[model samples]
Each structure stands twice: as structure tokens, then as C-alpha cells.
Target chain A: MCELMALSANVPTDIRFSFSGLCPRGGVTGPHRDGFGICFYEHGGLREFKDYLPSCQSAIAEFLKSYAIRSKTILSHIRQANVGGVSLENTHPFQRELWGKVWTFAHNGQMPIEQVPQPSYYQPVGTTDSEKIFCWILSELRSAFNADVCISQVSAYLHSLCNRLNALGINNILLSDGDAIFAFCSTKLHWVARKAPFGEAQLRDCDLSIDFASVNSDDHVSVVIATEPLTKNEQWLAMKSGEGRMFVNGESSWHDFGPEIIHKKSEPTKIAS
Target chain B: MCELMALSANVPTDIRFSFSGLCPRGGVTGPHRDGFGICFYEHGGLREFKDYLPSCQSAIAEFLKSYAIRSKTILSHIRQANVGGVSLENTHPFQRELWGKVWTFAHNGQMPIEQVPQPSYYQPVGTTDSEKIFCWILSELRSAFNADVCISQVSAYLHSLCNRLNALGINNILLSDGDAIFAFCSTKLHWVARKAPFGEAQLRDCDLSIDFASVNSDDHVSVVIATEPLTKNEQWLAMKSGEGRMFVNGESSWHDFGPEIIHKKSEPTKIAS
Candidate 1:
């Protein structure tokens, strides 16, 4: 299994605080040490950095920790190498250009190799089942939607596709196209939104803490989603199994359980300090 | 106008020496300070780094200078924007995947925006004429070939496409797909090959010199191409106007001029120390 994390904000926001909480899991605090990757979407452009070294030991990751690159949408992953070899090409957060926008996808769990469908337009450059599934989703989206179709119109359709993959195995995923973050939880995923009257939050993986009041203004709002909660003081809303949600401008705008599967909504899990 | 550099080698080679010679031109020695980017091909995978800051001032470029990443094929560009804004999306060495192989392109000259053809499949994410031309070429190639077609078999076709763009304006280009480096010279481009018995070479823009004999093995062979001669002691072969060439495994494998124009080949320019 792997770990996935994403951020969406009303304004450009630095990701260092949340990222610091997750980086330790790649090798020091957890066993997901195969590789690491992150994609930042800024001004309709994407910056991607990937390394085959463990995140805790990678120089690239170290530089990113110190570099204050502000972005509104971001997606990151740490791999454990279940379906592919440890390689630069097998790193998570694979990206492709669709309808003039850059689309990035990262997976957290395994899907049966035999059950994955063949892609027609987009092709996988790596041997990972994750990349193949990403390509398949893009290929299908290209066939079903035109360039003029709004991305929001395809949310339910995307949920339907994610539902099919969830049936095979664990299908936790994070996807984005510069505008919003689309999350699908088959096994595990949690999210926290911070706005006015923010308080201090302590890292769960490390001994670092950040006071949100000092860094954020009253109007600033941001939502962070991860495979596991990164902070102990914040109340992270855990998504129920087989659920899809779209986060836009620091808020959840749309959500749906696949038409085929009716899942009872679960209560939010609060991590006590 | 911008600066272009590329390398084709028989084995994986570190590009710091050549890159060091080109870095100064981005801001310190010349005026191409808009942005910089480089792409390295290693083990059938690609690593790309791009920054909006000038090469001389960018922390990312500084890290790359010392990182010592080795690869068999490399393409780099430092830009002086003409038709596009200085942003991450407008950075050179743009990349896209075709036929399950990552294709990268970097251009050093300008083309008339109105003359660029609209692409059908691949689309440009940036507003640069260079990116539009790249997408157009890829769209055309997708139509003319299939996944089964060997990349070498399509080199001649690629040259033809480049020739069309050259007619629109100055179009010096460097393109690679991990197998080889394809160069199209509309005006200025030079190259030199080094092998056994390699001698010392001094940089033209920096106060640094390297004795290749001390660093490289007897079997090492490398070809370096740039918009201008990068070394002060080497004999650089300048490509004729409207000529297309392919450098593979440290040697020029094929070359041709457009069928529409013919001219006498120019003599190699020798630079004295």
C-alpha cells in the first residue's frame, strides 16, 4: 500500500507544514519507502518532482521542504512498490494533458492486474498498474467527453468509473486538473478544513507543531486530504468506504456514492490531542 | 532568442561541465534570463527540471549544478521570452508522451505565431509559439504512424515537419525520445564529438577548465550540441541553414537538407584557446 495527500485552498498557500507531517512516513515513521513524488499546480501550470529514493533521505524532498512554493492545488504520494519496480518512471502522481489542461493522478492501493482495462488513446510509460489505470481513466474520459464539456459535469461519471475499480480491490485515489481535487475512498481517506479562528495543530508523524493563526488570515481557507490524518489536534472527517468527493476552493462542492452501491455515511473521526 | 544545449553519449554521462558553460548565459554573461529547463534520459525514464527564475539566480538550477545526475541523452534550454509571458508554463524543454515513450523538445529561436498550425490531438498548455509547433508536430506524427512504428523510421518525416516550421521563421530545435537527439538548424547550431585521447577544454563563458583525459575512460564517447560553441579550445561543426541531423550514441547517424532548398555545406569553425 501507499500514502496519498492533497491540498486545495482559496488562495495560494504554502504546503510545507502539512508536507512535513507526511514526509516522515516515507521511511522513518512508516514502511512506504520505495519512492516519492509531488505535483504543484500554480497559475494553470504544473510543477512535478519525483525521486526513486526514500522521501526521508531524498535531497529533492529536502529542497522542497525548504522551498516555499505556494500553490492552490497540490497532490503528493509515497510509494511502497507493490505492482512495479522502484524506478523514477514508477513514481506516483503521473500526469497527462487532456483538453488543454494538465491532469494528474496518484493511487494508494493495489488493483488486480488481470482486471485492469486496456487504454486506447493514452498509454502507460511505466510498468505500474497505477499508471495503467490512470491512462485508462483518461482514455475513457476522452471518448465520453469533448473539450467543451465542463469538468464538473463529469464528476458523477468519474465516480461511476472509480466504483468499478473499487469493486476489484482497494481503490483510494487523488486526482486534480488545476481547478479542483477529486478524491475517491475505497478503504481509507481523511480530510480537514481550516478557516477563521484556527488553532494549533501538532504533527502525528513528527514532533513539529504549527499555529495556524500566525500563518493564515481570517479570510484564508484550506482543505488538506490524506490517506492518514497527519495532525493530532484537528478533527479530520473520514470518508466512508466507496465514496467520491470534489474539493474546490477549500470546500467540498460535490459528492456521490456510486449508483450501484449505497453506502451509509459514517461519522467523522476526531483525533484527540 | 534563447540558448540551447544537448548531449548524446554511448554511456551515461554527467552533464555538469557542459551545463556549467551554458548557465552563465542565462543572466550573468548574456540576456536570456527569462527561464531555464533541462531534461535527462536515464534507464528508459526521464527527469526534468524547469524554473521560471534566471539560471544564475535560481536555487533549483544551483541544486542541479551540484546534483551530478547522469544520463545518456540530455536536452536543455535557457529562454529569452519573445511571444510568451515569463511563467513556469512558458519554460522550454516541454515534454509529452507519445507511443509510450516520453518526447521532449527545446527551441532556441522564434516563429511567427499566426503561421503555426492548430493541432488536432496534442495541445499546447503554454502560449508560446515553440510549444504550439511542438504540439502540431506530435499531432501530425500521431496521424502518420502507429505504436508499432520504430522511432528511427520516422526521423525523416520529423525533419520534414521541422522544415515547414523553419520556413516560417528562425527555428533552431533539439528534440529527443531517449534514443537519439534530432537537431534542426534554421540559423545557428554547432556540435563537437569527444572520445579517447580527450584533451583539456576551457569554457567560453566561465573561468573554469576541465581535463577530460583525467575524468573520462578510454572508451567514453560524447557529442555535445549547442546554439553556439560552448568551449574555447574545440573545433565545432556548424550546421548549414535548413539542415536536419540526428546524433545517436555520440555520433551523427543521419543528416539531410530540405528538398525545397540546397546549399553548400559550411566548414567546421575552429576556436583557438
Candidate 2:
């Protein structure tokens, strides 16, 4: 298993605070120390940083901590390497281009590589089952629709694919195409939406804290999803097993909770602080 | 226009010295300072660093200069932005995966985007004419051959595509699949190979000199290709107007001079130091 984290915001926001809490889990505080990767969607393109070194020891990770790159959507993962060998190619957050959009995917669970279907459109450069699964998903998306199709039109198909993968094992996934974030949970996933009335929060794994009220603007709304709650004083909503959600501009566009799917346009829910 | 640089080496080598010369052209010494990108093919995987800021002002470029990641093959580009707007997506050294290998491409000249045929397989993530040409080439490759085809078998087809693009405008190109480099020149491209008896060399753009004899091993061999001669002391070979050459393991695998092709299997040229 690995740790997955993501952010979706109405404005460009940095993930330094959340990333700091997750770094310790890579080696110092937990066993997940194989490699790590992070992708920030900025300026209508993707900026990716990946290393085979553990996050605790990676120089790139240390540089990233001090470098504040603001982005509206971000996806990151720290791996423990269960199925593939430790290599730069096996690092998480694999990226591909489809329909003139850069799509990134990162997985947090181990699936049977042999059981996964081979992809037709995209091919995996790495030997990880995570990469194979990502390619398979992209291949399916390309086969089902044309290049001009909107993502909202294929939400049902994407959710079906997520459910099919969830049936095999824990398939906590975070996927983004620079515009929106698609999160699916199989075993463990939690999220927190921060808007107005932001207060202070303390890190769970490290000796650090951030005062959100001082840092955020009144109209700034953002949602952070992670494998586990990164803060102690925040209320995090745990997603039920087999639940899938799509977030755009810091708001949940739709929620597929088992059988029933609820669109945010029809049933808008207030963001839980 | 842009500054293009590439390296093909028998062993893993760092391109810091050549890159140092190219960095200043982004903003300080020259006017081609829109953005910069570099991709290092290391450990059968690719590590890329790109910034929209000028290379002279980019923090990532500064960090990369000190990081010293070694690779057997590398490609770098600094853009001036002629057709496309200055953005991360428009940055050079565009990458795509084909035959399970990450192929990188960088162009130093402009081509008419309207005249170029649209690609059917790979889509351009950016709005640059350079990217469209790269997509068209890859799409043609995928259409002509199967995924399992060897690169050597498609060298002639690739050369034909290069010639086709060269007819439109200046199309100096540097492309690689991590194992070999394919360099084509329509107007300006130069290369220099370094071998056992390495000597001191001075940079033309920067006030720095390096005694390669002390730093490189006796068996080390590397070929550096750039849009113009990077070193003042080195003897660089300028490719003909429509010449295309492929280098592997620091040696010219084949050289196509106009209508005739010379295979390395028949005439292996010695490394020129």
C-alpha cells in the first residue's frame, strides 16, 4: 500500500503544508519509503517531479518544500513498492496526453498485474501494475469516445471502470486532467474542504502546524483528499468503499455512491469545513 | 527560433559544461529567452525539468546545474517562441512514449503549421508548429510499423519525414529514444565527439573553461550536438543542408548524405576528438 494525496481549488494554491505532513510517512515515520512523485497542473500544462528516492531523503522533495508552486489541481503519491522493482520508471503519478489534455494518474493499492487487461492505445513504460491500470483506463476512454468528447459525458463509464478495479483490491486512486480531479476509494480515503471560517491545524506525523485563517482569503475554496487525514484539528469525511467523486473548481461536480449518482448542479451540498 | 542541444555517450555522462554555455542564451547573452526545458534519459526512464521563466532566471535551472544527474543520452532546448505563446505546454523538448520507450524531440527552426498534416494517432498538447510536426512524425511511424518494430528498420522513413519538413522551412531537429540520437539539419547544426585524449575546451557564451583530460575517464566517449558550435576550441562538424545522421554509443551509427545512405555496419567511422 501507498499514500495518495490531491488538491482541487478555485484558485491556485500550494500543497506545501499537506505535503510536509506526508513526507515523514515515506521513511521516518512509516514503511512507505520506496519512491515518490508529484504533479502540479499549472499554466494549462502539467509540471511533474518524480524520484526513486524516498521523500524523506530526496533532494528534489526538499527543494519542493521550499519552492511554492501554486496550482489549482495537484496529485501526489508516495510508494512502498509491492509489485514493481524500485526504479524511476515505477514511480507514481504516471502522465499521458489524450485529446490535447495532459492526464495524470496515481494509485495507492496493489492489484494483480496478470488480471489487469492489456491497454491498446497507451502503453506502460514501467513494470508496475499501477501504470498498467492507468494505461488500461486511458485505452478504454479513447476507445469509447472521440477526441472532442467532454469529460462530463464519460463520467458514468469512468465510474464503472473504477468499480471494476475496486472489486479486485483496494484501489484508492486520484486522477486529474488539469481541469478537474476524479477521486475513487475502495478501502481507505478521506477528504476535507476548506473555505471560510478556516482556523489552525496541526500536522499528525510531524512537528509542524499552519494557520489557514491567516493564509487563505475569504473567497478561496479548496478541497484536499488523502489516504489518511493529514491534520488533527480538521474534520475529514471518510468516503465509503466503492464511492467515486469528481471535483471541479473546488466543488464536487458529482458523487457516485454505490448505485445512485448525484450531480452537484441538482443537489448542491455546502462544503464541510 | 530556439537553441537545441543533445548528447549521446558510451557511458552515463553529465552535460553540465555544455548546458552552462546554453543557459545564458536564454536571457543574458542572447534574446531567445522565452522558456527552457531539459530531459535526461537515465536508468531507462526520463527525468525532465522545464520552466516558463528564462533559464538565467529559473530556480529549477539553477538547481539542475548543481544536481548533476548523469545519463547516457540527453536533450535540452531553450525557446524564443515564434509561432506559439510562451507557456509550459509550448516549451521545447516535447516528449511522447512510443514502443514502450519515451522519445524526446526538440526543434530549433520554424515550419508553417498550416502546411503540416494533422496527426491521426498522437495529438499535440501544445499549439506550437514544432509539436505538430513531432506528432505527425510519430503518427506516421505508428501507422507504418507495428509497436514491436525495431527503430533501425524505420530510419529511412524517419529521414524521409525530416526531408519533407525541411522542404517547408528551416527544420533543425534533435530526436532520441534514449538509446540513440537522430539529428537532422536543414540550415545550422554542429556536432563534436570527445574520446580518450580529451583536451581543454572553452565555452563561447560563458567565461568558463574545463580541462576534460582531468575529469573524463580514458575510455569515455561522448558526442554533443547543438544548433551551433558550443565550444570555441573544439572542431565541430556541420551537417549539410539536407543531411541526417544517427548516433549510438557516441559513434555515428549511420549518415545519410542527400540521396545516398551509409550504414555504420559497412563503414564505422572512428571517433574524432
Instruction: List, residue by residue over A35-82, the lDDT tens digit for candidate 1.
Output: 999999885588888888899999999999999889999999999998
- How good is chain A of candidate 1, measured by TM-score? 0.94
DockQ of each: 0.54, 0.58
Predicted candidate 2 versus true structure: per-residue lDDT over A91-138, tens digit per residue: 889988889888999998766687677898899998988999999999
When summed lDDT is taken over every stretch of 10 residues in candidate 1 chain B, the lowest stretch is B264-273
Report the lDDT of model 1 for residue B230. 93
Positional deviation of residue B18's Cα in model 2 after best superposition, in angstroms: 1.4
lDDT of 2: 0.85
TM-score of each: 0.93, 0.93
Q: Stretches of candidate 1 above 4 Å error?
A: A259-273, B259-273
Error of model 1, residue B112, in angstroms: 2.0
Native-interface RMSD of candidate 1: 1.2
